[model samples]
Target chain A: MFIQLVVSGLLLGCIYSLISMGLSLIWGVMGIVNFAHGAFVMLAMYAAYYGDQLLRIDPLLFTPVAILLLFFLGVLVYQIIIQYVVDGPYVSRLLATFGLGFFLINMAQFLWSPNFRTIKESMVHGVWKIGSVMIELPKLASSLGSILVAALVFLFIRKTRTGQAIQAISADKMGAALMGINLKRIAAFSFGLGIACAGAAGSLLATFYYIFPDVASLFGLIALVAVALGGFGSVEGAFLGALILGLVETLGGYYVDPNWKYALMFLIYLGIVLIRPQGLLGRGKV
Target chain B: MMELVRHRRFPTFILLFGLFIALVFPWVVRDRFAQNTAIFVLMYGLMAQAWNIMGGYTGLISVGQVAYFGIGAYTSAFLYTHFGINPWIALLIGGLITALFGVIAGYPVSKLRGRYFSIATIAMAEVMRISFSNWEYVGAARGIQLPIEKESLLTFQFHSSRLPYYYIILFLFIVVNLVVYVLERSRTGFYFRAIRDNEEAAAGLGINRSFYKLLSIGISAFFTALAGSFLTQFSLYVEPDYVFASSISITVAMVAVLGGIGSLGGPILGALVLIPLSEYTRAWLGKQGQGLDLMLYGALIIVFCILEPKGLMGLWKRISTKKRTSP
Candidate 1:
């Protein structure tokens, strides 16, 4: 039972890691928490859902389309809203993303009608059992997809020119600018890339999870927690944080009461933050 | 001396006039809907004022103040319903308890800076919500419904008319504003602003950062709790979801931001504008639950943040200064 719980928890953590990777990148580079990140995921899910409904395309196949669409949307949002408040006070920056989140959720509600939709006949369905442990196919697919996408993003940040520029900006904004990097363009690109990850995760989630306007609230919040726990800007830390969150929530919920899972996650976060304000794998001062 | 006396007398006259209008507002208006809106504005305004102390002045932008408000409501309601304590007494006790809680919570929370601090407050509020929702002792998610009591000042209920509720909340609104007004110029106020503007500088000047932060949160919690208690007595119900919902915290912050943070009159102006706009929008466009009102609300916040970060007060200041200079 413990093995099964741990396995399932790890699988769930993959999707969480994918979501928070985007958040971590945005936070790391831009110094703004994209509160609308969950909304971006929600939008991607809707994109995948509509793609399947209208063209009879599988969500798996529609993933690239969702990613590109969300990439543009993310860039557009950055150019229009975030760019203005990037240098503003904490209140303005916080409210900008918060309002963006609210606006997107309500816009989704207005457009899609506040009803839950699921991809009933996804390309992946059914469960696999090995040695008395059951793994749902869609969840497994999501985990693999999440890891692949996360790896791609990780490589992009490590190897590519733009990715290195993003890293440079995050490391030291003024120094990066002195090195002839276009800070604005790089910031916008990073925001788009971060959101593109959400698009990928959302498409994967549509295969298993219900797609709704407010669905982002839960995932966005958890992703935020993951980002914070992993330390503000450390992608690897957020990944580990996501995995730990999944384990703690699943194992804690199973052993204790399921109702206390969220509370427990928050309590642990508070505990960790008090002791290590910079997060488990994060660098720099709080 | 003559100029100073005139300057002081002018504000006193305005104060007296404003008091007279507020005292007779419900009676003169004779519109239940308008009275109800007025009551909500005052209640929310009071809460926003409380938020301004910790958020605006102290630079701790907490998106989780609803936790204290919920605690206050739950504490008062629990005491009144279970122990048969008079609500007035329960209100005071609740405020005191929430103040203590604020100080305690502030200990660990005050250590966090900027976004981390805000996120921690959110996590703390979420913990409160989940705990209250799961606690069977307090009826869990079903919430506690207060018994309808005699309509009296002592009971804090008004069955005959909304007039009494209006007056009570109005008094609270005034008292809270008065407290903020005093705090704005007090030594503690300077300490709060000093910390907000530059924490290291304030700390260098022998100011204890965490202590002032705790003091700010405690005072904010006390007044916020008072508002919460009054809300329970007014509505005769206490639900964890309604009181502890994150939207309440957001709305309180929005009110402060919209009116102008770190100003005595900002919340009052914000409440006056926002409550009416929201209520009217909800009434008009919220029939099918299409969320137009919420969408507008969100857009307004975004637009205001981007265009005018200081809000209406900033706009007012700009226009006034421009006019003064031009003339």
Candidate 2:
């Protein structure tokens, strides 16, 4: 029983890590804590669900297309909404993203209605048993996908020139500008990449979890906590944070009441805020 | 003399006139729909005022005031149902309990700066909500239903009549506004603004940044919880979802932002504009289930913040300033 829970928890953590990476990237590169991240994730889930149900397209096959769509969305959001508020007051920036989120949520409701949807048929199906513990196949594949993508992202950041440039910009915006880095391009790219990751996570989760307009609220919030837990802007920290949180949530649910699990997670977050405001692995930003 | 009369005396006159309208509302408006709408407006107004203190003045931008709100709701419901306590007294205890939670929550959360602080607030509210939904003793996913035998002042039961709720909430609204009005000019308010503008500088000036922030947070939580308590009485049912939902927090925050975050009368203006408009829109378009109003308001926030971040009061000031400057 414990082994099964641990495996499930780890799988849950894998999805969380992928989802949170996008948000952390946005924050790290652009100093923006995007409130609409959950909403954007909601959009991606719909895309996958429709891709499957409406077009008879396998969600696994349509992942790249969805990711590309989300990338453009991120860029568009940056160009139209985010740019206007980049230099504005704190409240304006917050309202802008929150407004976008609210708009998207309502727009989805206006169009699709508030019904729970799932990708009924997928390329990945069923579960694999390892002795006494049972592991769901789709979740296992999804976690493997998460690991591969997370590794790719890590390598891209550490190895590539564009990635290095992004790091430079995150470290010092003025210095990067002085080095002739185009701020707009980098900002747009970072935003695009961040949202693309959100798309990817949505595609993976749609195979298993129920999708709805408000579905992003739960995962998005959890991703946010992961970002804070690992410290903002640290991908590896986010990974670790997500795993710990997922594990804690599952174990805590079993040990203490299931209802109090999330509350306990939040109290842990508060504890972190009090004890290590800088985060376990974060920099000076917090 | 003309300027003083227009600026100062006009406001006082408007306040007196508005008070008169509030007192005469139940009698003047015989329509049940309008009465319920007015009560909702006043309740949201009180909530906006509560949010304004920590958010507007202290620049905390909390999105978790719902934690206190839910706590207040549950406290009052539990006290009245289980312990057989009067809701009037429960009202006070509810506020106190919520405020106490605020202080405990704020101590560390206040240490966080910018988006982190705001995010923490969201996390706290989410945690509370999830916990509320899971706990069996507190009704779990199924909420608590208030069992009132008959219409009584002791239990705060107002079945079939909206007048009692209207008056109670009106009094609560006035008190909250009065508190904010005084707080805006107080030394603590000064510290709050100083911390908002610059924490390091505020600390340099010997202001206890976290202390003052917690004070405002506590006060804000106290009154916001009062509004929640009133909601429990007026609705006569308490649920985790209704009370602890993030949308409730967003609505209250938007009200303060729309009215003019730092201004004294901003919350009242926000509530007056938002609730009536929302009611009218609900009547015209459809139910909130359609989410049309949300889209409209969401777009409004985006456009308004882009164009006039200072909100309605700020816009009014700008127009008046331009008029005064023109010739």
Candidate 2 residue pairs in clash (backbone atoms < 3 Å): none
| Docking outcome class, model 2 | medium
Per-prediction tally of clashes? 0, 0
Q: Kindly report which residue stretches of model 1 are placed more than 4 angstroms away from their true locations once superposed.
A: B1-20
Candidate 2, residues A36-125, lDDT tens digits: the string is: 888877888899888888888877677777789999999998988887878777877787778888888888888889988877767889
Off-target runs (Cα >4 Å) in candidate 2 are A1-3, A131-133, A154-165, B1-14, B25-29, B152-155, B287-289
Q: Which ten residues in a row have the lowest lDDT in candidate 1 chain B?
A: B3-12
**Can you tell me the CAPRI class of model 1?**
medium
